[model samples]
Target: MVGQRQFDERRTLDRAREVFWLKGYGATSMQDLASASGVLRGSLYNAYRDKETLFLRVFDDYAEQFLADAAQALAQPVVDQALRAFFDFTITSMTTGVPTRGCLTTKTAIDTKADGERIRAALRDLLDKMERLVHERLSTGEARSRLAIPPAEAARVLITMTRGIVVMERVYQDPERLRATAAALIDALLTPVDPGRRSQTG
Candidate 1:
């Protein structure tokens, strides 16, 4: 019985996550959550206590999955391959599956106010992890003479560019344009330091 309850809870959370993703937290009501998750309001309240608690739980699940995907991208043998994996994931998130859903982290960050300090902090930590992953990749790339700029700087720029791209996706929603931008950004970042070095050789 306990196992079945747990499974049902997760299934409901999955549905809730989708609802929250599609509609921001401020806009999602208890009734909406109940309808979307196909779980009774009484059960949801009994399980999660309130809307804020359930939203946080759903956010936790989203963050965990997002970081796990990042870990996979970072696990690639080559830095360029790792970066490509990261960009691919970002592009897919912005354009495919869930349309017009720029990013949960971004949406939450933009929508939340002083009351959402905890959520903001959690989002910052996740972004830091992403930046660190890029930094680590660039550190390795630097050793191979693949980068002209400092690893830290490159990572910062990449993170900034990625965030910008994510925002732009909400307005533009053009996959090819975003892909071109990503390709250009990668090319610029991977360019070698030496004047004589025309390509990424190593």
Candidate 2:
């Protein structure tokens, strides 16, 4: 029987997620994880195989939480309000959040090595999912009426703009600036386009 004193996998993964989110994969050593997780290095290795494995697990958890939050925001009755909530969340995450390590996926991608390709790919996939969610939310006639571009193209633009905002906030450390940028981006998204022009293309 498993002893009560035995460490919980879920708990350990949660702790590791915080640690990695606070520190990038390369910056976080096994010793740091051991200390943060309250588990010995040998035990961590035994449970997770290696640092990479542990990092991947943590990444998965982060991605899951991100997607869940975005989905909740998208559930709002007004699509524009939902999109604003999404941007607000992004700004809040950048200015606050426990890790302060910037976006994990972007950070990892910038410094990826041969072995880190899989991690990069996972991050890309998550972004793709987000883009799709945005596209679906914007595809409705009411939402499309407020958009300057097609639903698919507008989704892509919003994703890119939001990612850029996050990156800028990380470097600038200015909450007001970030908020202004977010507002501008949302305004651009909410600007009405000509239905006649859209019909011409159709």
Candidate 3:
């Protein structure tokens, strides 16, 4: 059986993550965490040492969940299918049901202070992992003919495009716009490479 103190600590961290996810690190206060976590301020301090430490725990949890979802999306049978699943997951998660806190990493990236730097670094690590997943899925020989450009370049472009879509969806709240943009991106991905078009025939 878990000790009372340990159970309370876990509960506090879970509630703290929700608060941080909703309000962001810069905006959230210790009072807010204490209230949201349903724990007294003294106990929160005892468990986490401080707000920064608590926020780091929340950030770690967020990164783990995001990467796990991405991994599942990338696990489809084919690269193009995997890419589509990945984008679809992002769109559906952002738009479906009640609007929850949007991407926590994107929310925290603009702060640029100490905690912000930590959050940004974590986000970069997540992006790097995502890019690697994309490269692996696309590097399969069967995926070659479907791609207009090299797998590495396409992965970079696709990831950038997907991130951009998330930003737009966060701001605009237009599902159709997001869907259209994603379709256009997929069309571009499906376009055939044209090396000959770059040459000066005249």
TM-score of each: 0.85, 0.86, 0.82
lDDT at 181, model 2: 81
Residue 88 alpha-carbon offset, candidate 2, angstroms = 0.7
Q: What is the TM-score of candidate 3?
A: 0.82
lDDT, residue 192, model 3: 47
Off by over 4 Å in 3: 1-6, 112-116, 191-202
List the global CA lDDT of all models: 0.78, 0.78, 0.75
Q: Mark the 10 consecutive residues where model 3 has the least summed lDDT.
A: 193-202
lDDT tens string, model 2, 105-187? Answer: 67676654414666877888889999999999998877887887789998999888878876787778776787778677778
**What TM-score, to 2 decimals, does candidate 1 have?**
0.85
Give the range where candidate 2 is weakest over 10 consecutive residues by summed lDDT.
109-118
Candidate 3 Cα deviation (angstroms), residue 9: 3.8
Q: Give the per-residue lDDT of model 1 (tens digit) for 1-202.
A: 5423533878898999887777877778989999998888877887788887888888888888888888787678766777878888887886756556678777777775314767777778888988887887778744347776788888889888878887888888887788789878888878645655536564
